[model samples]
Target chain A: MVAINIDRFVKRYGALEVVHDISFDIEEGEFLVLVGPSGCGKSTILRMVAGLEEISGGELRMQGVRVNELSPKERQVAMVFQDYALYPHMSVEQNIGFSLELARVPKAEREAQVKRVADILQIGHLLERRPRELSGGQRQRVAIGRAMVRKPQLFLFDEPLSNLDAKLRAEMRGQIKRLHQTLKTTSMYVTHDQLEAMTLADRIICLFDGHIAQMGTPHDLFDRPANVFVAEFIGSPTMNIVPITASKAEGRTVLTLAGGGEVSLPDGTALPSLTNDGNVLAGIRPEHLSDTPTPGATARIEGVIDMLEPLGSDILVTMQVGGATLTARCTDKGQFQAGQNLTLHFDPARLHLFDSKTQMRLG
Target chain B: MRRLNPAAILMLVPTHLLLLVVIALPSIYVFWLSLNESTYGSDLTFVGLDNYVTVLTSSYFWRAALNTLIVVNAVVYIELLIAIGMAALFLGGVRYPKIMFAIVLMPYAISEVVGVLVWKIMLNSGSGVLARTIESLGFGMFNWSVSPPLALSVVTLISIWHHLPFTFLLIYAGMLAIPKSLYEAARIDGATPWQEFWRITLPLTIPAILISLIFRFVFAFRLFSEVWLLTAGGPARLTEVLAVYLYQSGFKYGEFGTASATGWLMVIGSLGVASIYLWAMHRRMLKGND
Candidate 1:
């Protein structure tokens, strides 16, 4: 049975539909993330699931019970807000135990449960301190602790780590994933940061223009995005997209990059039927473009280096290849300089092709 | 931090000198006069705290002090409740709350003496609307100004009418400043409506509450315009609060020394209340919370 099932969930703010009819099911103990850019209605969907927002047109069921009309309290869910929403007047102890107190649980049991959750989050020492007295990460932990102490049927996290600093955000991202693993509670998270979705989600729903562009595991999304949007949106230093002319000649597909380069497909490589002379958008991830030629490289292109950014783990190089700029992530131990001409190899198997008019994946 | 520029310090000297001349000088003179014996036209004689001792022991002074204390507490507490209720209603998405808030603030916009005069006429025993309405309701001739409790209640009502808007606006703005996400979090935590208000709204608005409390408290403690303009110390000094007494001592009875002493006492009383509230605010801040 599904833990949370949203059937044709629609959110319309007075004729302007923010989220078009979108449907997805979350399984029990699943860490589902709705990932999108800002204003993509991802947070709206999470709010609808949490019952904080009314489902404008849909049937919502939680663990087989229809909850469309249920108040947030009756929905039996807990949410961690992006702002940490730690009651400034509440001590960590009170904040953690707040849900239990609202339930009118006995004080001794409330204290015990608060302590138990505090121990799990490693916030035992900060229990007496107010949220103002705690650091950002500590406040985040207290926020998560507050949600988890309820042991609710579902957890909704609405960009809960977005307000933290970079280092704290990454650390808390891992901690949240671990918490989900330990509890195995059905969870729905909303975030605009694809990295967080990649790191933490069991399944990710990538939203675009109010609709689900694609939904899959991080591996599936990174490896096989449904369209150009998904392909570009999923990866960091995202997939390089450029229009290319395609044609069938002598039973092999030939391509000419709009940026002024050519590559011929290997024989017997299956591809969608191509017009004699037609244009389609081509997508290649920076990771797939190599600074050095590979043994089985399908094509090689020459270009001058436009710029270089050396991130500690990898070097990201932008090359003025063909007639366009293409970013390539390279870890070539050899030193490279900007404005130098170089040839970068590409493996055709990792290439993504999308129909220009339809913007849908073709090959 | 950058050191203060000498030019900036030099620029501040004029304003500080003005404040010393306009405020500091007169206040020192008042304290000096309180330590001496003087009448409206008599030469000052050094008496060394005799006026303070006399005012402290006088029954009328105690009565007026009690009246001031009662009025301040009654006005602040009542206004606080009304402000919170109105602010909550406005924030609860009552339609046209802005217009309603503006309407409720009408009394505050009116001049204090004018407001008092309007209420005085409205409560007039012979020709007032309130008196006529009460009389029509079989209360006989509604002589409200003579009864101590009723007279004080009238003053309290008018004061609340004048001051409710300020406290309401402060609390309302504070309520607005609270992130909507906190309410969402509370709802998902299974809190009832009452719990949400008590836990989230009240505690989070403590700063506004403290600020409005101090402002309303001290302001009400120094009440004079309404009391003097409406009732003029009333039938047998029943509503003669500290400010009215100060006015009566200097202007009516021509007791300048006693009046200055009363003025100093009023300042001390206001500071006492303010310090308690400020101390509580500081203690809460130190005890931890944003």
Candidate 2:
């Protein structure tokens, strides 16, 4: 079932339109994430769905009902804000039960509902404490508890974990994922952090300049990015994009690197034929490059290592190859050093190709 | 007890000296004067608590005290309601906010005596613009100079007009300090506009409200100019407030001892009213810390 159908939605502030005509649908139990850089109108779209922002044009439907004119409460949506907008004056119990109180639920029933949510969030012992008295992680749980108590049709989270320390953010991220698994409520989360998007979202929508850059499942986004932006944005350590010239040589596609190294495309692949010899972008994931060749490895590129960042299990080795700087995640822990000439091999089939001018993926 | 830092004590010397010269010395002199009987150059005769007894037992003093209590309460509470309303209006997004703010604060900018004199002229029974307008509208003349209630009402109105900007500024700042996200959260929680005000705005702005109430109560207790300039406790002193009674005892009848006693009474009365809010604010702060 379609939980939300955002059709040709437009948002304008007077004469300046921020969100252009955009359309998408959220499935009944899907966890969809809107990921983008700051000011990309990701939060605006989320706010429009929550009815905090007005939709200038186009229709918004929830559960097959048009909700463009409906109030946030009427739309049956609950939002966990970025700052955990808990009432500082109210105790945790009151904050969670505030919606019930406003709905005029009986006292005993409201208390029971609040208690149930508190226990689910594991914050029952902290119910009597005010928001100011709770720590950041505890406050976040209370905020989620507040939204969960509503049991609305949709859950909207606006960068809900951005304020926490790294350790707590991961912990809460896992908790949120677990909660979603148990509840299976349709959720839309907005964040500038791609890792959060990649981990928490069942499907991710990458937005750029108020337009949908790409929309696909996490695996599709990670393994087969639709464009150069999605290719660079969806992964940690970011995909290394090096400009190269592609031309046919000996009935095979030969990519000529800037530093005069040549790597040929793998045979028996369904890659589209190159009709012209022009500038193209070759994308390689940091993790895909290895100091030791793999079974499918058919291309080797040499570079002088310039920097090394140790990450306990693996090291990020940044090196200068011709005119481009590429960071490769090298797992041979102590084998690489700065200023040392090294050769990294990658599978030709793992290469992502994009038109240099359009920045669009080629096959 | 922690030992006081000599440097910190040294840094406070100037302020302490100023307070001693301006407030402590004068208060002590007043207390001393209240226990004595003196007239211009006459020798002082110690009459321990006699002046307090005289002022406390007098019917005129009691009437004046009652009048002061009524006027102060009416002025503070009515002005608070209007200030809160104006603060809400400003918060709801007013066009040309800076200009509107200036206009709201204009009353405070005008000198208190000048403001009172302007109200005095405007509220005159026969020739005043407002009086004629009201009479033409079939509300009859104000008769502020004759009727005791009318005189007191005029005083209250002028006092509120002159002092409203202070309370409004405080409450408005407090309301602005409340995070916008809280209201958005409340809205999503299905809160009506009234509920948002009650649950979010009112609770968040309570400290500011309490601070303003404390200031207004203390300031309004010393209400003299509005009543003195407008009616001068006229119609057989029926509109007399505590300050007027104190002024009459000292300047008009040359009873310095009784006047000093009345000054002490005014201090106690102001403190009595202000302490309630002070206590509430303290309790709130403690809870916040908790």
Candidate 3:
């Protein structure tokens, strides 16, 4: 069921359109993350949804009522910003109770609501203090508390975890996810961090250049990315992409790589008709390149090792393959040296292909 | 471990010297002169506190004091309202805001003497454009030059116009420095525009407002140019303010002792009023933060 539906929403600043006509429905009780690099219009779209920015075209609806013309107060949505814009003069209690105060809620009820949110955010002791006295993490919690106290129809978080230190970011990520689960509220979270999107989102929308590159479940996006951009953007080390041409060898598919090396596709594969001279990009995730291939292994590459990073459980090995630097996550603890030859294997099903010209995924 | 802290103390010596040569000496001379009956360049006869006592008991002094208080409150309150309104207007991303802001600051740029002169002609009963406009609009022939209340109101308006730019700029910068996200949050919190100003803009800009208030109050108490130029204590000494009273005592009557005593009283009165305002406001701000 749709909780909030954005129908072909467009945002323009003068003659320049920052967010193209983008459409999506946030499901009831679902946490959706909008993930992209800078200038991808993720934040712009979030702001438009929050009613902070005007929508140039199309309609925004909450619970089936068109809200494109409504002010933020009428839309019944809450937002937590990246910078934690807490009022400097107001105490923690006042910041949280501000919305209630604006709504003219009774004094007793407002106090109870403020205390409930403060306790939930574990900021009950700091109620009397102003924002200047709180640390970054505490300020962010107060920002979230301001949003939480309202229990509005929708929640929008725009990179709310980005301002904290790494350890604090991780901790707050867990807290946010737990809070969402407990409240079961529909949420739209925007961030440039793919890791946050992968960890917290029930669904992830990968945006690129003001367009929706792909949107799906995190597992689906990670395993079956729609294009080279998504394939490269969703993974930690990013997917390794190399130009390749396909031909037939021994009644099977053989992809000739950039450096004149060859990698064979899966055995006896039913294939699509292709032009022998057509160029395509072959994508392989770093973790997919294992020495002892997991399952569905059908391709191999012999390359000279460049560098290795021992990341505790898994060693991240760098090697030059087909004139492109490729990173592999390997568990092998054997002594390895640069300039040594190493053979890496990968799953054929995970070998993503995109048309070199259009950069869209291909069979 | 620091010797005489001469570096910091020496840094203050220049300001102290300027104050002494320009302020302290004249002030001490005035107090000494006020202790005796004297005119400029005449030998003074020591009369104890007679000059102060005489000035304090005078009905003219009380009337001038009352006029000063009226102007101070009127200008401070009226200019504050207009400044806040103008500041909010500038923040609305108005087209050509820089040009409009420059125009708004013209009052500050114009010399006080010239400013009051210009207003005097415009407000003149016979040929002033404002007077003609008001009379044409059915208000009848306006003659502020002969009425104390009308004269004082004209003086108040001119004062508000001349001093508005300072407070307007201060409040405008204060509004701009407030993070945009705070307003965004407020809007999401179901605040109407009025509530946003009352809850956020007004509260956050209180410090700037207070500073503007103190500045305008201190200067308004010294109202002289507009009152003197436009009305000159006309219609039976109705618009005579403190500075105008002091000027008349020193120059018109050549009573330097009484004038100096009146000057000292004016200083003390202004300081007392301004500090009370600052203390009350700052206390409220600190308590709100706590």
Q: Which stretches of candidate 2 lie over 4 Å from their true place?
A: A248-254, A259-276, B1-8
User: Which pairs of residues have clashing backbones in candidate 1?
Assistant: A259-A323
Clash pairs of candidate 2? none
Kindly report the root-mean-square deviation of model 2 from the true structure over all alpha carbons. 2.0
Better of 2 and 3 by TM-score: 2
RMSD of 3: 3.1
Who wins the lDDT comparison?
2
Model 2, A218-277: lDDT tens digits are 898999888899999889999999888877667766778888766645664445544246
Q: Proportion of native contacts in model 3?
A: 0.89
Stretches of candidate 3 off by over 4 Å are A249-254, A261-278, A291-298, A308-313, A332-334, A337-341, B1-38, B43-50, B93-99, B281-290
Q: How close to the true structure is residue A144 of candidate 2, measured as C-alpha lDDT?
A: 97
Report how far off residue A16 is in candidate 2 (Å). Answer: 1.2
Looking at chain B only, the TM-scores across the models are: 0.96, 0.97, 0.94
lDDT of 2 by residue, B1-290 (tens): 99999999999999999999999999999999999987777887899999999999999899999999999999999999999999988988899999999999999999999999888788778988899889999997768788899889889989999999999999999999999999999999999988888888888888888999999999998899888888788788889999999998999889999999999999998998888888888888887831
Candidate 1: list runs displaced more than 4 Å: A275-277, B1-4
Per-residue lDDT tens digits for candidate 1, residues A1-363, read 578889999998898999899999999899999999899999999888888888899889987889899898888898899898888778899988988898999999999999999999999998888888889999999999999988889999999989899999999998998888889999999999999999998899999988999999999999988998899899999999988897778877777888677766666666665433478888899999887778863666678999999987789999886787789999957577999997778888888888888888885
Q: What lDDT tens digits, residue by residue, belong to model 3 across residues A117-165?
A: 9999999999999898889889999999999998888999999999899
DockQ of each: 0.81, 0.69, 0.58
